[model samples]
Target chain A: MIELTVNGATHRVDVDPATPLLYVLRNELALNGAKFGCGMGQCGACTVLVDDRPVFSCLYPVSSTAGRRVRTVEGFGTPEKPGPLQQAFIDRQAVQCGYCIAGMIVRAQALLERVAHPTEQQIREHMNPNLCRCGTHMRILDAIRAVAATGELHRAGEKGPAS
Target chain B: MRWRRTGYVAGAVLLAGVIVFAAIAWQPAIPPVKSPDIAITPELVSKGRTVVALGDCAVCHSPEGHPAFSGGLGLRTPFGVIYTTNITPDVETGIGAWSLDAFMRAMRHGVSRDGHLLYPAFPYIHYTKVTDDDLRAAYAYLMTQPAVHAPAPRNDLPLPLRFRPALAVWNLLYLRPGAAPALDASPRERGRYLVEGLGHCSSCHTALGIIGGESGRYLGGGDVDGWHAPALDVLAHAPRPWTVEQLSAYLTTGLASEHGASAGPMRPVTDNLGDVPPEDVHAIATYLMTIQTSQPPTAPKAGAVADASQLARGHALFDGVCATCHGDGGPMETQLGRPPLAASSALQGPTPRNAIMMVLQGIPWPSHPKPTAYMPAFADNLTDDQIADLVVYLRSTTSQPPWPDVRDEVRRARKDLSHD
Candidate 1:
């Protein structure tokens, strides 16, 4: 059994140590926000935050996440009360297929947390790792830009139930 | 009274020594010549191009984003940094004023047209063996190039080494001027001339002494820019012994299906070799094969079992980090035909330096030509402990014993990274 703290809640799970974190998040913990795209690290569909740093959960072993805080898209907010970044996405309609949005949001959250008001160039460069095949990049950028403009990222989760 | 006489004797001896040294070291400047109006034949220029390619002049003299041969690349040495000189024929800053005789003397004697002793970092010791005809050909090719007026940077050496005349003593110790001994007309002989004279393979592949001369181990392996240049004479001892055909392929394309891709300092070398004629590469390979020292392949030893927790950590790290490309049935192996990690020379080598370097500074994607395999650098992404774990896990898969000094190697590689 290995201890994993996801979204501020701790859980003990029994799984192969080498199994990717994405598998545990989706299967055992039932946090299905992080999806599987390419099993390789190429695609960002399985991105999640390990101690506030975005990593490809599909390629990240669950063993390595022990004692470290892991945050999935579910940690942002519920559908009833979306986080500020999430609401920005909805406001901008930044989804075509929605497969890559969770990763895009998580990656952008990392950038915003590090830089409260990132410039256009900073946002583009920081978000470069996460790919949006649906060509929803412009809308995603607008959504992230909207969140950055308001400086309300800290209030993103205040209304939602704490994990 | 006796001590004062002794001091005077010592002073006189020192003064006499300085005078004698100056007499031996001072080289008279060759009178400057007008840029010659001799019409260079296209055929001669083409032949000169081949000669220049074999010599790998651009690899040193052409800093990236600079015009070809208009040099400003700083070569790091144990003594200090020596910057490459502009070889372009610009009359003001480059070698435009140098006559053919001046050029030949620089090649043969490691002296500049301005009567200063040239640093051995220019590799004139090996160049001294180049035939006069080939040197003339190289000059023809260089003189015809579009001249850029980039002046050479001053070397950052210790105060004593700043005296250019000190190199005259160094030359006396190491320089051997004259053409390479003529040989029967064979591909191997042609390969020898190129390798010894122009290619100067031994300059890197051979170990160096404390004073920076060849240690006489002669292709017994050496380090350059922190990466080990593996011994060429022991190619037979490689995990999969290198054949002439495979070596030729590797020399031309920078990849061998049986061995592995070139990385580190060898990458640019193989890239340059790729542009040369295939026959030249084949001849080089042929010559290299003839020099291989025969040694019986050792039987694989049983490795000591690693600590269970460390093994788990290492395995997990590999699955997460390396498995995307290097795992069994990975995309690189299945689709792209990259060799298994078992076949990698770095993993199978006695030391873990190369493996650590490869992980920290992954094979960068080449800009020109068709792209080959590319691995992203993990220097910032992975910690020193994490890299050591990965290296240990990879070593466990092979028949070789675990590198006991993996942590040290990782730290060394990190230091090398910062130095770069």
Candidate 2:
């Protein structure tokens, strides 16, 4: 049994230790935010936070995050009380198809926590690992910038009463 | 002993090559076929013009920004570029010296007046099937063009190219010079002949082989230059399935009431098609409608949230920016000439790419004087988010499937179009 602390909820997932963290989160815990796109580490659709650092869940083994704090889009915020970053995304209308947004928000959050004020270039470089095939890179960048300007980068994840 | 065996093998190969070369290079005795002696009447010239248009003569032969039929277009081939020859009746430099029999032989057998092998780039394989009556009329029309002094550009291909004997071998393998099978002399058969033969639609629409002959996939759609020539065979997938009437309108006037105005390489083809009789276009369309291309259905809407507010946002955005031009009885669509959005294939189609592209790129004036409609690019002015909302809203109004990840598409489309 693998113990996964996703969005502050402890769950014991009975799967292959080698199973992609994406499958465990989605199938075992019912977290549908991270997607299964290009199952290789190449696409960031399967991204989630491992101890507040962005990692591709598609490649990250379930066993690796046994003790690490894991967070999926569910922990980010609900639609009713969406975190500031999610609200910024709503304000910018950054989500399309929304298959890639969960990963994008998580990665952007990681960058904002470290840099606090990321230039357009820094944002682009930081988010380079994630790809939105539909070409929403510009809007995603704008959403991140909006979130940064409001200084709500850290607080967006604080709500929802500790998952 | 091994070296001796090798020498014998080499000598046998050399002997075979020599025999092949001799056979291919042998000149046939020219039969005295008289040129049509009757004076060219106005009727003959007009009929000949139709034949020329049917063949799309101006597109390949007439070099861009050059005089018509003076032929300096450089057609790319796998081996190298083959420059189109001057077809204008310049006595010294063009087909003026070619007798009627010689011209027919070239059209039928890929042979020149001098008994040299002509390249398949001339499309004689398809031209071989063109009726003699049409051929004669086409010639009568060409003979009327003013003989320009300009000579064709020299073909800058690798050595051992365009040599009479060598090309004959290439022809022997690839060229099946004969008339295409006609089940009956119906209008559909006539359309098939025109589409497959002198019109040589398949030459561009079908993929080419390594030897540079038509792969004969037959309307499977091939690329001409950079733009894609859509498939016409069972693989054809228009946003809205093409009906005979819509195809006829598109072929005759380059505009269909349903969707998509001709662009890129298709512009010249549609323009040329306008010169032909409407009945001819109708016949072509009749034959084309029989082709059934099955494409995979759109992605399921399982993951879609379908929130009412999300749709409302899109509807609001469309009303603000697009309603002025695309609204019901909007000035641009109703009065000016833009196609109606409700009947637009791009909006209702399985994919949002075309509609989104049209919105982002907009319609530009084609080189031809026809259509005269214009839709300016919104890539610079509209925010990606707004375009995403607009595309979704427009699609919803038309009852199209909700496209996922549209903001990314808008962003990428803007980048791609900016480069263009």
Candidate 3:
């Protein structure tokens, strides 16, 4: 049994420790926000935060995160009370088909946590791993900027319900 | 005995050395790509941009966030979903390292730089018709794009379809010979090349009938990813059949009079083809109008009639199995606003393979705002010969001009349908 805290909920999952965090989150924990695009660490659809650093969950083993805090798209907030990033996504219409939005948002969330005011180039470089098919990058960048303007990034250190 | 053993050891060593040497020599070299000697002028760039717009290479080949032409798009087909490969000039991942001749072979012949036959799913059959000049320009434009190093996922075709060698036979039968067959013969011919070659009309328009060669006719519909190829027939009775002007309008805007908006597979085609030069689009319309409507070129003349006894047997089988939808008023035209046999382009279109395929594999109900016709697959109920005769009977009665000897072709289509 491996005990891990995802989105604020502590859970025990029975699986091989060597299994990538993505499979454990998806198959055992029933969290599908982390997608399995290219299992070989090419596409970054399976991005998540481990102790506030972006990691490709598809390549990150569960054992490596034994005590590390894992945050996912679900960790953000519910639809009724979405996080600033989620609201920014909505305002900017950054979610076309919603397949890649979770990963993109997660990456952005991690970036904002590190750098409060990121330039467009920094955002592009940092968010390179999270791929979107519907040409939503410009809108996504706009959404990120909009969230930054709201001063959410500066106060990212404030804990919100352990998520 | 000791001498013999020594000889054997020496022989083994020699064999290993030869094998290693051969592998070193045969390391499938990627020939260097040479840009045309002509200077890159504003006019050249503008022309290349137009081609890019028409080709829409950026749409499928380049994912939204990826560098332009750094491909990773997932294209779903019936056989298996294939990912688009990177077209960038990256030496490690993209075609940046490909020779001009290699690129030409890949585009015109579907052979890759590694000397492997690419799957027809790549639509090289249509790209094969691209002129040397246009291909060079397109290559030049791609070369100028950013070099992105990202290898795409390989296609996962199921079972025998994965067998690459068999494609050679399929190519021999279906693929037209030679590159962009001299369009100088006529203006209409040039238009046909542009549409059929660059436009890739056959990829969607040609119905892959239950049989082989029997299904090569252009713009004869087939189901791909649940999207039916709407007949582009010029006949007055075709479903929302458009005049040349109307066709151009629809191709440009993805909408037309009486017809609903183009959706599904057609969306991409129109999205790309709409950007083509107005004159080119008009030329396509001209060529499309000239599609042989009376009959296919290979159809047998009336003089070589089928045996009367055989035809009689075919008639009886048709009545027993096919009379329900296709009988009495002789296959209702305008079934659910879709034209029936009386007004069908099928009667006037080339080849009976599509009709035969429909009978064997019954079309999936067309998806529209309003539900259209549904036909059930009949493989379980009918034999190959029975289906063939039924097809012949339909053509003899409804379609003008006799059909070609399609028995073997139908047999092949049936085999493929069975596996599919």
Candidate 4:
């Protein structure tokens, strides 16, 4: 048994200690937004936030996340009312097949959280760790850039006062 | 005449009461309709022509050697044969007399001017995602095509299936509510409109459900026209993940580094997509590469070198037989610019079929702009076992694992090999 906090919700789950966090999130918790791709951590499809930093869930053991806070794409917002970042994605149509988006979004979310105004090069460098086969990297770049230039700053400004 | 209207309704009621199964109409969540602003200028026609090409309408609508868009192509499906309708300006047989309103309705609602429910094979489900301006332009362009007097052949359907009303029921059961695409207005958005709307990329790339609607992760791939339409999503299963540059290059030119080349139905698609603006193709790629899925990795490959004995056999064969064109600075590399074996996309994908297909049926004549460096078929020249060993040798040298059934793949490719 392990304790896991995901998207602000906590649950206790029983599984093998070595079971991948992605498997638990999907199979046990039914949090399916994070997808499975290359299980070797070569593809970022199973990306989620561990303590607000993006990590490939497939290679990350569930045991390692016992005391950490994890966030999945579902934590972002509902489809009807997506987060600013997700809305930016949909508005830019930055998704296809949308299997990688949860990771893409979470990874980008981490980047934005760290660097509120990343340059295009910074954006590319940050996103290179993830692989998208559909060739939508440019749109993904734009969606992130758009969010950085506009909404990211506003949210960052709001957070600076408290943090 | 007075009783005809009442008779139709009463007969429908009686039919419903008797069968209780087949007579119900399907109700789809239809998007709110928008009246298109009409224009028939030459520029609009030119734009509309691009839209038509974007849709690849001619390929399916007109069979080979037939007048373009004449609409006699038979699309075989589980249900039955559904023939494409003529869109040329013929009053009796084609849509010549359809007003802009009628055309808009057809594009948006999948209904004919006479109110016949169209079979989904027409891909109106995707077309409805199109914007009114583009729809108008496509309509204007279609109207300009030379009128074809050809009437579509009668659909060979059975008694209950012959009635178009069943489509209403199917729509009710399967069709999700349609909503106007919320527009944010970016080039990527434009790409989305073309891809999701007119290009209908998902139609072929997305796997189909039991009832024929899109299933699984959209663009996760399925069979289309007898060829495996590889998934466009992140579970792409390409031996090497497609880089955006490689993807754009392939989508625009039909060949990408490492993945080799597009063949089968993809050839024509590349031809049509190539004709679109380069930026538009990039936009489509931009949209494609972002879709993600995850799966557990395949077991780590045993080793770079396979069984030492088989490796030696494959090496000897390659040196003796394949050495002429495939050796370092060999004819294929120097003259044809074919990548070295280590870099071949065929070797990189999850399966060996593409590589075997290449060996058995060398790239015939590449489309123009792509240099034509042809290779002859090796099926007649080499034994299946030898060919399989050669591929295994190539695989052993690369970081990629040897495909599971090399001999079986070679046999299959040889059986289907043709000069075309």
Candidate 5:
């Protein structure tokens, strides 16, 4: 059994040590925020924050994240009470097929945490590993920029701002 | 009066030394000739193409996004950056006016048409062994190419090296200008001629001294642009020993089932070799097999467990970043037939330099042939600490002992990346 602290909750999962974190997250825990797009790390649909760093949870082993903090899109907020970044995404309409949005949000959250105001170039470079086939990159960029301009993401983590 | 007489004697000795040096260093300029009116046959031109490919002339002479043989590539050396000269037959800047004899002299003696001493970076030491027939064919092919008027940038050498005559002394010590000895007409002999002469494999494969002269350890391991060119004589030491067929396949296609794909500097060489005839590559493989120095087989010892905290971080990084491509169940191994990381020579080697470089630089898309194996560079994505962790994790999986200084290796690789 591997103990994982995910989204402010602790769960002891009884599975093989080699099982991917994505499998455990969706199967045992039923937190389906992280989608499984490409089993390989090429596509970032399985992105999650391990110790505040974005990693491909699909390829990441659950055994390795034993003591680290794992945050998924669901950790940000629920559908009715979305986080600042999520609200910005909703306000900017940064959704197409929506398969890639969860990963995009999780990856962008990591960047926003590190850099309060990322330039367009920095955001583009940071988001390069994630592939969005729906052509909603401009909207996604706008959403991140909107949140950056408001500076609400910085305050959201310390004190949850009402949506 | 006694001190003045001693000064006069010292001055006289210095003057005599200067005169002797000048006598040995001076070379007369060859007269320029018009583009030869000789009718070159298509057969000769075709053969010349093969010869030029074998020589890998364009690899040094041409910079990327430039016309072939229109030289401007800067070769970084221990001395300094030496720019390659334009070999295209442009009358103004290149060898358009060079007569066959002038070209021959440059190839065999490291002297330019204007009597200037060419640097040994041009590999004339090895070219001196090339036969006259091959030289003529190469000259014919180069002259037929559309000339580009590009002059080379000045070399970035120190003050003493800036003096061209100094190379004359260096040549006297290192250069041996003559054709290689005649051998029986066999595939092995043909391979030897190609490898030793025009192929110039030793230029990179052989170790170098402080002055950049070959250290006489022919086909022994050497470094090229921070990547280790593994010793050619120790094929038997590989996890899956290389056979003639495997080497031939690797030479032409840049991929072997048992061994990893070629990356870094060897990629371009294999890309060039892909265009050559199969027989030439096969012969090279055939010849290389004969030169193998057998070693006592080492028992695969189990690696000792590493620090738990560091191992955990490394395992996490590997799972998140490296395992997608390198894992046993990874698509690269299952579908593309890439060997496991344990089989990689870079991991099994003495140092962590190549492994660090492989992660930092990865393999860029090939230009000549279609891309077979491509890995995105982690230099920008992963920090030095992360890379060190990944490398340590990889070494732990191997049968060999852990590398002593992985973090230092990563730092060195970062330095090389900055230079690039």
Candidate 6:
């Protein structure tokens, strides 16, 4: 049995400790956002955040993720209220059929969390695992930029001071 | 003085440990080295762009309004519908994180980063035929594009079917992941790969069992996008067996000698093929011609009937059910824009699969620009044995060379088209 927090909710599940965290999330917890693609972890279709670091969930076993916070696409906000990256996908019309979107969002969230402002090369270097066959790559960059700009706007509007 | 010196030594040791810890913890995570600057010179870019166009990567990769190279297209096949994924450079969402080696494996080896076999439907089988240099150039061009973060849609195939390891079994039967067959025959045979593989001419040109395996009457057109794909081999009818020059012209411009213009699915092929270097097109033409000529399918034996009464009954059934469109004296030219049955080389081919498929499925009505011809499916009306009797009757009555091997073809076609 392992305890994990996903999307702000805690869950305890009994299963093979060596099962990929992706399977635990999708099959055990019924979180379909994280997918299983090329189970060997080649395709980044099964990416998620473990302790705020992006990892291919297909390769990361549930045992290693015990007591860790796992962030998935569902955690990135819903259709009614989307997170910055989720909104970015929509604004750029980035989700075609959308099987890769969740993984893309999960991976992107890790990058944005660490590097508030990433250059094109930085973004490319960080997220090369996700493969899109539809060829909407340019728009994905624009979507990320849009999200960054929105983040900046929010930061400027915030009231802040160190006590 | 001794006590003060001891304190200093301990402090120095603590400082040294702190420095070592910092060195290990804050190591700069430099990205791996990519293929040394592919001289994206205008000439190189142009070469890469042409290859991109030839491969029609956009047809499978690009979705409407999506950034180019960011994938979202949906391809439906007999097995199931598979959605395209995002191929952008998004650090989190796209392949911006992949090494060049990973990309190469996916393309050439049909293996992904984690080492799962990709389905053949991805056409890596054909792509594997692409040269490393060309693949690199194409990759370079894609790398230059903006990264989209859109995810691919879930493949709705059944459970074990969706399992990646199952592909290991599929690979044994069909996946030969490598370059196209090396042509040792004439230049024409060499071009067959370009036409059949990357050109994907066989995707439409070849008759397939409804489930997507090769049909007996190879290159006798099948159905795509609701249009009938016309037969390409000499064994099938199109008024004339396309000569090398004619096929080359048809492939390049969708025009050929006095018979028909390519439209519908052929439009994209011609539009793309039109831009193909003339030399490549010629090579493809040479290859396509050589394959059929080498095979030289013999016609079924002529003028022999085991039972005269049975032949008469078969002939009577042909006149009633089939002769209106395919009869010897029927006005074949106006109804089907088709060649006369007596004159069809397809009739002389070893098997009557082509004729049977056409008769059963109906010819794609060709419209100029794009064909909107609708051929109604006939399985609801015809039985397996009845279709077989018709096959025997047609070969005996019309085909110059009797089609003796038709029984197996009928069996195969029936099996393939069972769902239809």
Using lDDT as the yardstick, the better of models 1 and 2 is 1
The CAPRI-style docking tier of model 5 reads: incorrect
- Specify the highest-TM-score model's number: 1
lDDT of 6 by residue, A49-130 (tens): 7766676676555655556677888887887998888888897898777777788878777766666576776777667667
lDDT by residue (tens digit), candidate 5, B1-420: 999999999999999989988877788899888884345788888888988888889788865656889999888888888999999999989999998888889999999999988999999998899999888888889889989989899999899988989888888888999989339777788788888888888889898888888885689878878788877887866767889888988888888777878888887788778888999888888888888877733443433456877777787777666776777787777866667877777787767888988887788655444857776665644667778888888888887787876887799878876655
Q: Across residues B271-319, which tens digit of lDDT does each residue of candidate 2 receive? A: 8898888888887887776655566343445225446765776666555
The digit string of per-residue lDDT tens for model 2 on A36-114 reads: 8866445688888887767777755565675678888788799899977788889989978888898999888877766
Candidate 4 is graded, for docking, as incorrect
For residues B1-420, what per-residue lDDT tens digits would candidate 6 score against the true structure?
999999999999999977765543232222433332445566666776666766766656765446776777666566777777666656565566656666666777566555656665576656777667777766666666677887777776777768665555444554566666546655665576566556666666666564345554667556654444655665223335567787777777655533434444455566667776988889887876665644544443653443565556456555444554445655443543544555443343444665566445543333223522233233322445556666676667552545554556667665655432
Scored by lDDT, the top model is 1
Give candidates' CA RMSD values in order: 7.0, 17.4, 17.5, 27.6, 8.1, 23.4
DockQ winner between candidates 3 and 4: 3
Q: For candidate 3, list the clashing residue pairs, or say none.
A: B31-B99, B32-B99, B89-B96, B210-B413, B211-B413, B332-B340, B333-B340, B334-B339, B334-B340
Model no. 2, DockQ = 0.01
Collision pairs in model 5: none
List interface RMSDs for the candidates, in order. Answer: 3.2, 20.3, 25.7, 21.2, 5.3, 27.5
Instruction: Give lDDT: candidate 1, residue B398.
Output: 84
CA shift of A138, model 2, Å = 46
User: Cα deviation of B112 in candidate 6 (Å)?
Assistant: 3.3
Candidate 3 lDDT by residue in tens digits, A9-74: 889988665467888899999998888876534456877888776766765556557667899988
TM-score of 1: 0.75
lDDT of 1 by residue, B1-420 (tens): 999999999999999999989986999999888884345778878888988988989888986556789999988888988999899999999999999888989998888999999989888999988987788889889999999989888888899988889887888889988989439677788788888889899989998999999985788778887787888888877878899888898888888877788898888788788888888888889898888887733444434566777777888888776787778887667754457887888888767888888887777656465656566566644667778888888888887777776887799878876654
Residue pairs clashing, model 1? none
Q: Is candidate 4 or candidate 5 better by TM-score?
A: 5
> How would you encode candidate 4's per-residue C-alpha lDDT over B77-107 as one tens digit per residue?
6566778888887777888777776777677
lDDT of 2 at B62: 79
**What range of 10 consecutive residues in model 1 chain B has the weakest lDDT sum?**
B296-305
